[model samples]
Target chain A: MEEGTASKRAAGRFCSICTQRKPALRRPKTLEQICRECFYAVFEEEIHNVIIKNHLFKAGERIAVGASGGKDSTVLAYVLSELNRRHGYGLDLFLLSVDEGITGYRDDSLETVKRNEIQYGLPLKIVSYMDLYGWTMDEIVKVIGLKNNCTFCGVFRRQALDRGAAFLKADKLVTGHNADDIAETVLLNILRGDIARLSRCAYIMTGEDGPIPRCKPFKYTYEKEIDKYAYFKKLDYFSTECIYSPNAYRGFAREFIKDLERIRPQAILDIIRSGENFRISTTTRMPEQGICERCGYISSQKLCKACVLLEGLNRGLPKLGISRIKAGNDGSGRPDEEPTRRGREVERPILESKPCGTLDF
Target chain B: MHLTLEFGGGLDLLCQSVKIHQVDVAPKDENAKLTMRDLLAWVRSSLIKERPEMFMKGDTVRPGVLVLVNDCDWELCGGIDMELEEKDVVVFISTLHGG
Candidate 1:
């Protein structure tokens, strides 16, 4: 059945369940027979169960939902607010948005999130990249160059979310990462052979073991479903991606996985299941968790990569500490040249006796 | 013989293209001989452009590089310690976050 394809005004397709005129795009990766409304119902049901089964939400927990004002997050807010009301989840729901200082994209998205806060009747907390990091994303990208925007966003956003959650006194932080997102991550880790991350990221409900348990209520939901839900529900969300995001490796993985999924519909799910089955023994020297000296976030080292990179950005040497942030483009300040290691509080004993009278030292 | 080298995401920028000759794998000089550790060192110095870790012959591979044999992931075996056969495909990918 070529459902809805034969309609005269193919520019707009009627969602049978919601009876809303959805813009006729190519049918989703899944079948088009399932109207946007039905997909949303299915999406919410799956999320509710994923949360309930995992005990993701705790009793009297204050939840800070990370709302980027994107479709995924906007739909997350709608579902979360609805779930709180219908099930009396007793969740103190609040919107926590990180304005990454992307000129057109983040600015527009935050506007949508603001409207969503009013519509959902949830308190909103807005954090800006400029306020927190002393540099806007655009400015950082210009200085640091195009290679590490995702690193900037991901690290900063993670810390930003935690800060916002803390400000809200949130017991739990909810993100809008869906099944597709997770599955792509699984593939990327597998491709990288990152056993530690592969092992840890397998679980649907993550983030709570350390400080504030971050949960993904939309873990089981697909991107198509999230888009459909936002469309049918008339939820406002940013349609455009962050301009810098196209070059991100995660985006590459996402595209690769999506292409593979076309060949085998179960590819995405299979990858995620593999991640679930995969386990890392404790014997492996995984990145040990340590508290950041600058910000108290758990990291592998004393000062987290975020703090080190921020120090670099602020110091006008944007490539420091981790090369992943620089993507190996340029050796901005080699450790051999600088007297101080990125996180080293004091010079090594090896260096103490050598440089008493050097003009630079 | 030729071995295809693949890299994921950010590493793709380092060696937009990489080719390690099969002869280079079995060099006469021990100093010139390449191990998985050497590759990591080269990548750390050449591609990663960061402070070189004190990498040795048998330390665990950084979670970044994925040494694949043909099309298969070495994790299916011992991982990191999986010895390289001639013309073995080596694919390096970045650690991902999600599930």
Candidate 2:
């Protein structure tokens, strides 16, 4: 090792875990200073352990990774492929991306996903908003403005990913939602009193009862580690704020999480643990899940949020799906009934204060 | 001293969207050696063009920003107090962006 001076060289610290090479990073989960090689070993092995312990995958299964060309998903795609090959998991992996049709933001990131498809040699399926919803985010933003555009994007993107997975005929779907993302969702859900999502947000795997089972292998992985891994490995991923995302509310919660992480990195995992342990009261009325009457997508309401929002957009009353109107106004107040044009002028407050994004449950 | 500074994970946005830079930085005092704390001040004044808060807070990097000196985590080198040498490579990456 090159030494500026003998004294400074003496102060060099070796890897705490390997006790050999210089430590490259301090893992947030274990707070252990590890070398680059050991970091990769432990990081991958921890994910493999999480997979095996949770039984997230089965032999000869086709799994689609919900890739956004972001750091977390990029690393997830790389690691999953590596593990499948290394351990003989006998799984077929596919990269699934949703094109929101935002001009400068998503368009740029999708290029990275395209590159990942070639780099990882995984088949890619991109489902676009224009094809599915008949409107792109750019078009929606033009009509709806920035105030509640995220609601439209969030609702649409969730269904788009599911539809893409169905088209791919993959047995399971996985997302790159990390510990920090889940912890943020937990906080947002609690703040909004969204018991349904708050109870399930901490789950590593979800949608078992739905058409496609979705899992989060990085449920406990810290975002910091993912970022560092991508940096050290020179992983090619895109990082830019969405053009349409003001996300002021979620930004506050995200900032709070970062602040707490600074104080105690363990707080991120603890918040998720607290969320997982919360038990809902039996007496509380839960929203019943049923197929949407119009679109046949899964929904708690008679019509899915997508159909409701689409109907409003088509009817030139984009707020119809989002506004809180009294129940049973138009016989069943379903999408089939034409919403009254008179009450369209009245603005109601958004009930769910949860931040709208791809990770929304 | 000449050093290489690389930014990634959206940290490049603060630096006119340039990801890498080769620059010359020296200690504030002529008789003393440079430390990470001094280099941070130099980077903030010289390189960061916008949203300084996104890069730093309270004399160190903002939470969720990872720093590496000579390709090794600065945490292993006493964080902001680590002594810097000529031709060292310093990398900063932000993990606060959406996945």
Instruction: Supply DockQ values for each candidate.
Output: 0.01, 0.62
- All candidates' TM-scores? 0.64, 0.91
**Lowest-scoring 10 consecutive residues by lDDT in candidate 2 chain A?**
A348-357
Error of 2 at A129 (Å): 0.3
Best by DockQ: 2
- Tens-place lDDT per residue, model 2, A1-361, is 3456322633677778888876777888788878899989998999999999999999999999999999999999999999999999999999999999899899999999999999999999999987776578887888788988988888988888887888899999999999999999999999999998996889988888777888999999999889888888999999987877755478788889999997899999999999999999999998887766655566777766776676677656788777885222222222323333323332221211111112346
Error of 2 at A283 (Å): 1.6
Please state the error at residue A216 of candidate 2 in Å: 0.0
Quote model 2's TM-score.
Answer: 0.91
Q: What is the interface RMSD of candidate 1, in Å?
A: 16.3
What value does the interface RMSD of model 2 take?
2.6
Error of 1 at A272 (Å): 1.0
Error of 2 at A212 (Å): 0.4
